[model samples]
Structure formats: C-alpha cells, structure tokens
Target: MESNSSNPYKDCLVNEERRLIDERTNVGTVEKKKIAIHMAQSNSDNHTKELDLGTKTPKPIQPILSAYPCTGLGKDRRCFQPQWYKSFTWIEYSITRNAIFCFPCRNFPTQPQKGYLFVIGYQKFRKVKEFLTAHGETNGHATNVILWNHFKQSLIEGTIKEKFVALTKSEIMPPGNAHYCSPPLQNQMLSAAGNIILKYIASEIREAGYFDVMADDTRDVSSYEQFCICVRYVDKTNTPKEFFISFEKVVDLNAESLTKTLISTLNNNSINAICVAQAYDGASVMKGHLSGVQEKYRKNHKMAIYAHCYAHKLNLVLISACKYLPQSRKTNIGENRASWRNFCQNHHSSENNDHIRSYKIPIDTLNIYL
Candidate 1:
C-alpha cells in the first residue's frame, strides 16, 4: 500500500483538481464532468445502487449551544439563539456559517420555495418560526419528507425490494428525469413482487396440513381462458381462512387439461398432500362423472372429496325457472296490466291502489251531473 503523500501521481491529481473547469473556469468542460459523475451514479440496467444514508440524513442536529457557538446579535446586543431551533429532527445549526439549515431539505435538494434556508443560511431569529414554517410547507421539502419516511418504514418492514425502489426513485436517478422510471417497468416489478409473496403464502397453506381448493375458469378481457385457484384452511387462530393462490392461462378447456394444470400447480407449490375437499361450478368439463376434473383429481387423491358448488346450482335453478315458468312472464296485454296492478298492490300504498280502483269503477249519470 503506497502512501497518497508519497505517491508519484499525487501532483498529477492535485494539478488535475486545479485544472478542473467549471462555469467560472471554462466552457463545456464542467458540463462534461457533471455528466460523467451522473452516469457513474446511474443504474442503466435496472439495478439499484447502494443507498447513501449520509445524503438522506445530512448534518445531525445537536443540543449543545457551545458546540454550535452562535455569534449573531440578538435583542440588547446579546449572542443570538434561534428560537425555532429545539434540536428538532429536521433542524441543523451550522457552526461555520453561524446559521440554521433544514436537515431534510439540504439532505435532499429540491426546488426551493421561499427565503434561502436550504441554499443560503437562515439567520433571521425574529422571523425564524415564519421562515421555518415556509420551508417546511414547500412542495419539494414535503415530497422529500414523504419519500424519506417511506424508506424508513420499508427498512422497518424488512422489505428490501421496496426499499430499493424507494431509494432508486428518490436518490439514484438524476433530478428532472422522471420519465426514466417508466410505468410499465414499475408494473412489471410489482407483479414480480406479488408472485413472490403469493408463493410464500401458498407455502404457508401447504404447511397447514388440511385445505380445500375452489377453482373457476373464465375468459379474460384479452380472450384468454384464465383459471383461478384459491385455498381454504383453518389458520393458527382457529379461524377459517381463504386465500387466492394463482391465476393461470390455459391453452385448452377440456376436463383432462384442466385437471393436469391444477395438479401441476399444486405439485409445483409442494402442496401434494391429500385435499380435504374441492369445489367448482357445475360444468360438464368440471363436474362430469367419469372424465371430469373432479373425477380425475379424486382418483389420484381419494380423500379429496368433490362437490358441485351449491351457489352455482342455485344460479342455474334461477335461470331455468325464468326460462320455463309461465306465471313469471306476461302472456298478453291484459295479463301484463294485471301483473302491474298486483305488483303495485304488494309494493305500494294500499290506500293509493284503492283510490285508483275507485276512479276505474264505472260512474253513471249521477257522477256526471255532480
């Protein structure tokens, strides 16, 4: 390990630092250096960079007045102490500048809204509360606070993925490059996270010993035959719990294919234990005697009892009754009128019905004269 003091390239580094060009030095050179720094910090391949915690918290607030050593004048020529400076979480007193700075605001730079508490030091003690209030209410400061709080919560929850996303969005990407974090990419990340959580829950269900499955298939908006699987089990609290496990797209809707898909899902999740029960809607493909999903599954696990869901049975009954029942529908105009009157009598005021009936009654010459 060569000492930096004795290194041969030490002068080259010092000269390089002096030669560094900025707006005050030369044209186009400072911009290039900044771009280099940004690129080095950026995650071009969808990877999260390591979090710089020092940048998030910045200068820690302390209570010792002597350590900060304020020198500015106060009422009656006394050394000033910032009234709003109570060693609050967001407050930090700068010893070099002899002024107060917002810790969270300086830690995460955003567009300043008011007097230069964040950029320039805030020293006006008389208006300290007013200035502090204004700085705290700024859009940029509020946003930073929310992001910082969310990051802290994620750390507490032990959610590394969420913490990574929060840190990347807040710190890694350069300011004003919001489009770099595309919506589609975010959705994909969320979906991946959901799959991980779902698998863990499925594992929990498998460990619960006895569970039942409820399955159903429907055509999604994209015209794909999507199968949904859910498991019901008694949880640790002795309460019945039901959780959705999977939504899979199937190429075929036959009894055999459906049964195979179900079996494959269960096996993949290591849920091969004997099923306590199974429930599905009454379709020939699902509930048939010899070749249906229930039959096939039952053959493999005899303890897995199959039942045609009673809810589906009731729905089918209602549809059949509407289709075949004669009294449920109007056969003629007179019958329709009678049905309307019957409905009004049952659902509306009987007094109003009687008044309507009285008006309908045939009034002779006496009523006409009156």
Candidate 2:
C-alpha cells in the first residue's frame, strides 16, 4: 500500500492497510488478535501516564506536640529574668552574696543593703514578681515568695531601720502650683461637679424674680417613688426658662410632707417667699375645700386662690350645648318653647290674672264690631 501525501485521512488509511498486510504475512490467522492486544496495552500505558501527571504529592508540616515541663526547670524557667534587679543595685548585691557567701553574708550585710530590703517588703516583692510576669518574664513565683519572706524578716529587725532616715515637715505640700495636687483635689472636683447642676438651677431662679412651680408625683424607671417639681419663669431679659428644680425620691406626698419639703428647699436656696406661685391641675386631693393643699395654704395666706382650669370649664360648656341641641337641630326651637312655657306658668299667678282679663275684654269687643 502507498501513502497519499495530499490528504491526511487517506494517508492514515494507507498506514493501516500496510500494518494489516505486515501482520497477515508475519502471523497468518493469529495476526488480528496480536495487534488488538498490542493496541490495548498501549492505551493503558497512556491512561496511566495522564493520571500520574494529574496526581499531587503532599508535603509534611512541622508538629507542635511538646508538653510543658514537669520539673521546676522548664523552658519557662530557662527564659526567666527578674526585671526589678535591673533598676536597683542592692538587689544584684543580695543575689550575688546569696550565691557566694551564703549564711555569713546575711549575718554581716552592709547598712544600705539592709535598708533597701526593709522598704521593699513582702507585699512589694509579690507585686514586683507580678510586674515581671506581666512583661513576658516567667517562672518568678517561687523565687518571689522566698525574697518576700526575707524582706519581711528584715523589716522586723531594727538593723534595716537604722540604715536610713527621712525628715518630713508637717503638712508638706507638693511641688509647683497648689492646683497640681490631683489626688486630693480629685475628690473635691467630684463633689463640686455634683453641686454644679443644682447651683446652676438656683442661679437661674435668682435672676428670674417670679416663677410658677409645677409639682407632681411619679414613679421612676427603678420603681422608686419620686416627686417632680418644675419651675417656669421669665428671665431678666424677658426670655422664658423652664427647668426641673427637684426630681428626687421621696417617702410620701402628703400635705404636711409636701409642705415641709417645699419650705426646706425654698429656705435653703435663699428664695423669697412671695416670688414663687404654685399651679397644679384640678385634682380633688389638691383643690379640696377642707383637707386639700389649697385650703391648707389659705389658712395662712388668704390670697392663695384656686383658679378654675379654663380648659375644664370650656369642656363643660360644650357638653351642655350638645345635651340641649338633640337630634342635630340647627336652632334649638324645642328648647326655646320649653323655656317660654315655664316663664308664663311661673309669672301668670293671682296678681297677673286681672291684667290678662282686662286685655281680653278689649280684644273681644273689637272682634264683634269688625
């Protein structure tokens, strides 16, 4: 068989034709079976090669399986360094003497070294260990306990006290301006801040000579009984300022109780007695003639009047008009007729009967002649 160069499909067919001829000549009737087996083996090899190219090999990662040490000298102990030793030389000296001289050095320590241990007692020693641990230094707990005990012993012995002394004047003030003393002044400032709001309210009331006070009782979010006393007044420049003077938790709101609270609050603030006017809603308890707050004040100050609330009076008038104008009448003609009949019935009695008879006789004579 000859291959065709111009067409690729014809060329492949020619190659197959040559292969079949070769197989037939070499193996006779068994040639087709051998060729099929060879082609199957080649396809299997190509498939395996493709799979190998697509497969991935995993890499190993470092493991963190190490446990903390059982013994005192662990990794944390190896990295431990006492931070307090860096600042004070006495600490370094004590450590060196403890390591070298042992018991002899403790019996014959220098004056300054004993004094330093006395001031930094057990409490301070424990605090220093905490400070080291907070800054990433570990394994100082046991050593801190030992040092703290030693320092506490040094405080008990007088050998540590005679080493150093300081003379402090009575009422020694801090350096710089007096305002710079923040520790004590901080408390003062806190108290002043509390009073600032109340003082401001008083100043506002003082500037506004006359004010109307509104008093009411209400419960707060915390379920505490509280009295809300608000002041409405105009300032010197005629600008109105309305603010709460008192919103405080109270035990009771009885007449005596409320009056006592009012007197105390007014007197404490140096407020004039006549400058304040009280206004409240038409509550029976507040305006009752005998036992109400209005009556109580009227006993002392007769001018203490109870003005009828205009809004309530207007409501009464509207109700009366609606009751008289039933059936949605444009004009109350029925009401007028009823009013005229009642007037005539009341006026036409024994004295008015003679006047009515004379007027009727003239009317009758005129009617006959006509």
TM-score of each: 0.41, 0.31
Residues 231-331, candidate 1, lDDT per residue (tens digit)?
78876667888888788899999998999989888787666555889999978889887888999988877888888785565455434434544554545
**lDDT for 197 (candidate 2):** 68
**Best prediction by TM-score:** 1
Clashing pairs in 2: none
Regions more than 4 Å wrong, model 2: 1-191, 298-370
What are the clashing pairs of model 1? Answer: none
- Looking at model 2, which ten-residue stretch has the lowest summed lDDT? 96-105
CA shift of 159, model 1, Å:
17
**Candidates' C-alpha lDDT:** 0.61, 0.44
Superposition error at 194 for model 1 (Å): 1.5
Residue 365 displacement in candidate 1 (angstroms): 54
